[model samples]
Target: MPKMIFVNLPITDLDRSISFYEAVGGRREPKFSNDRAAMIVLSDTISVMLLTHDFYSTFTRKPIADAHRTSQVLLALSADSVADVDATIDKASSAGGKVDPGPKQEMGDLMYGRSFEDPDGHHWEIMWMDPQAAEQGASAFEQA
Candidate 1:
């Protein structure tokens, strides 16, 4: 079986978070979801577990940091093309997520990326890269 990644996040509103994730190419997996938590399946191997603050705290002794005020991690996903990257970001924004919480990223055709903040301010980055450049290394694209 292929390995999978489940990212657990602390959110305030389960319903809203579920909707936001859905807008960004995710669908709620009811078998693993409940009132306090929702399992958003972003891809075959990528899932985001949205847990309320109270529920999330149960998994860790450390205090829950407010994502809106602090940064803990940046979650990134790859896209097939630059248009796809932008489309994801656009959908996120339409779903009420903040667009471009940080500056947009462009690496002269080598890579293209953009960021957005979920309702709870969790950061997400959508990116696309030149396939050949990625396999060949950035130096391969360097000018003479």
Candidate 2:
């Protein structure tokens, strides 16, 4: 069996988070979801468990850090192409997510990336990488 990953996050609104994830290629798994939590399946092996602050608190003794004020993690996902990275992030912004102000990164023809923040301010990065470009030592960076 293939290993699976569940990234658990504390969210203020379950429904809104689920909607946002759906816009970015996730499907809700009702079997593992409820009023307190929603399981958003991103891929066959990747899922995001959106839990209410109260529900998430039950699993940890530490106080939940406000994602709006401080970042604890940056959730990243790979895309098939640079266009996909832009499309996904654009969808996220249209769904009320905050697009990061940073400039997009383009590493020659090898890699491209962008970032966005969910309503709860959880950071997410969308990226694409090409092995052939890397193998040829192509670079977009200017040497000083």
Candidate 3:
């Protein structure tokens, strides 16, 4: 079995968060979801656990940080192409999510990426890479 990545996030409203994820091309995996939490399957390997405030609090003693005010983590995903990355971010924006003012650019032979923040203030980055360039060990920062 392959190792799966689980990203847990605290949400004010589970239903609303689920809707937001759906609008961004994520699907709910009911088998792994329940009233206290919902599993949003972003991809086969990447899944986000959206937990209610109470449920989320159970996992840690520390207070939940308000994403709107401060960033706790930045989530990034890979894309097949730059167009796909742009479209995905556009969909996020149209679905009530906000795009960050500008994206950081890292030029390379075969790597491209962009980043944005969701309505709930979760940061996300989308990237595309060329397999050939990867094989050649090209680094985006180096090319830039």
lDDT per model vs. reference:
0.92, 0.88, 0.83
Give a tens-digit lDDT track for model 1, residues 8-115.
999998999999999889999999999999999988999999999999999999998888999999999999999999999999989999999988888887888999
Q: Predict model 3's lDDT versus the native.
A: 0.83
Candidate number that wins on TM-score, 2 or 3:
2
Best by lDDT: 1
- Say which prediction, candidate 1 or candidate 3, comes out ahead on TM-score: 1
Q: Which candidate is the best by TM-score?
A: 1
Return model 1's CA RMSD, one decimal: 1.5
Compared with the true structure, the alpha-carbon lDDT of candidate 1 equals 0.92
What lDDT score goes with residue 58 in model 2? 94
Per-residue lDDT tens digits for candidate 3, residues 1-144, read: 799999999888888888889988999999988889999999888999999889999999999989888978888898888888888888888877877534654565467788777666788888887877766674534664
**Candidate 2 TM-score, true structure as reference:** 0.90
How do the predictions measure up, each by TM-score?
Answer: 0.95, 0.90, 0.88
TM-score of 3: 0.88
Model 3 residue pairs with clashes? none
- In candidate 1, where is summed lDDT lowest over 10 consecutive residues? 135-144
* Per-structure clash totals for the candidates: 0, 0, 0
